[model samples]
Target: MVANFETVTSGVNLNQYAGRLEQLGPALDGIGAYAERQVKLAIAQGRKLSGERLAPLSPNTVAEKRRSRKARGILRRDGGLLASIQFQRTRANEVQVGSNLKYAPWVILGTRPYKIRPKRKPTLRFYTADGWRSATEINHPGLPERNIFEGAEKAIGPFATATIAAHLEGDL
Candidate 1:
């Protein structure tokens, strides 16, 4: 038998896998949206993506929130942080979910103990168990680590498998 075959260097087909591979980009897009929704949902419920309940708000915090007309939920105030959650698609299979809000890190890792004083006013006025009080300066205990966003990021690991499988199957 005599045969002639031209050397091929491109347009290689991945056979049956090509179709699924093509679906990956769209899959990642969906995954990012899905992940963002999951994180926001977890936060709205005042829990971590791991289903861990967030730390309870201090009495002072609750009282102040009520008086200031802010949402009285843990890790929630005026809904800015929740609305700021975002996801960026960086590659065919990679997406990054994060926030541009400056205080997001503080929500994730908390803060060190510090003094809180009025910058413009002579004293700080806030509510407490004993009712309204005024102070020139107050020692604030460091906030407890919420880590809700981090927990959601971690939980997405398991979700990635399911999401990809669903995407490939056109079920996502």
Candidate 2:
């Protein structure tokens, strides 16, 4: 025989919190997928707008630099605005890193010169077989923010449905 445990009731429905947490997973997954697609689209868009002649560094090197200098120049011109959207909390994909989000608005400009200090000791240096590289790295940091945004948006529609379901279940 199973022992019946007496339950205490609270003003807030306990099921709601559990339901929210359960719903969070799918929301996150949808967000992740959206973010991945957006990054790829952005990369493609950037490459198209660059108008750079992509020539082989050598006949053997087939891995083309997707972004051209002209594209980078254009990106740099508007990078400040992009950075602002990236860092803004109100923006769909804005993310906050260490320090504060305030720095984001101007950080993308690349206008600030990086200061080089003399090394205290001789640094070990070696030349790799590969030559120079492009500025476009595959890392997309906006993904998490995108996921959160999507999750939040998804939650609104489901919240009402879930609440109604809970009420009906309790009635039975």
Candidate 3:
């Protein structure tokens, strides 16, 4: 079933492609860390991976930010969430980049109007534009979808692909 190579002037070594595929091992190993970095960079730049500017913080949130000196920068309160953004190797060739914070979902995916009430207490006390107030329940307007996790796919997708391609081609 094979053609005669004796008549051919140039040599054909199809095995080269198989060897190139070996480069994927290293590329896969580093992809997780690379993706985490891109996500953090996008946050610092205050932009989405698609080059769109991130939505501004809510007005009440902004006021809260101003009130607390510990809150520095957008979505950075005490730097906990930002520092929590990391890469975890779930499998030999698989990795996940995200935060373990409970509110990460709320940050990426906007919530609908909901009621917030005291769980351990008889009532709730919070400050408002008018001043401090006491209530049994409060209606939260909810937040907008930041879609920060979208950074991983949009920013790292092509970069990782190109890196693996370059490595496979021996051009990395």
Better of 1 and 3 by TM-score: 1
Pairs that collide in candidate 2 are: none
How do the residues 78-140 of candidate 2 rate in per-residue lDDT, one tens digit apiece? 344233222112222222211133543232222343333335534322222364433322222
Candidates in order, TM-scores: namely 0.79, 0.25, 0.76
Q: Rank the candidates by TM-score, best first.
A: 1, 3, 2
The alpha-carbon lDDT assigned to residue 8 of candidate 1 equals 20
Model 3 spans with C-alpha error above 4 angstroms = 1-15, 19-23, 89-94
Q: How much lDDT does each candidate structure score?
A: 0.73, 0.29, 0.65
Off by over 4 Å in 2: 1-17, 47-111, 115-172
**Candidates in order: C-alpha RMSD to true structure:** 11.0, 16.0, 10.0
Q: Candidate 3's residue-wise lDDT over 28-135, tens digit each?
A: 656766777777777677666676777787666666666665564566677766777887655444567778888877776778989999999999987654556899
lDDT of 1 by residue, 1-172 (tens): 0001111214645464457766577677767787888878887999887889988888888878888888877878989888988777765556777677888888767889999999999999879856899999999998888877645546776666677667656676
Q: Pick out the ten consecutive residues of candidate 1 with the lowest summed lDDT.
A: 1-10
lDDT for model 3, on a 0 to 1 scale? 0.65
Give lDDT for model 2.
Answer: 0.29
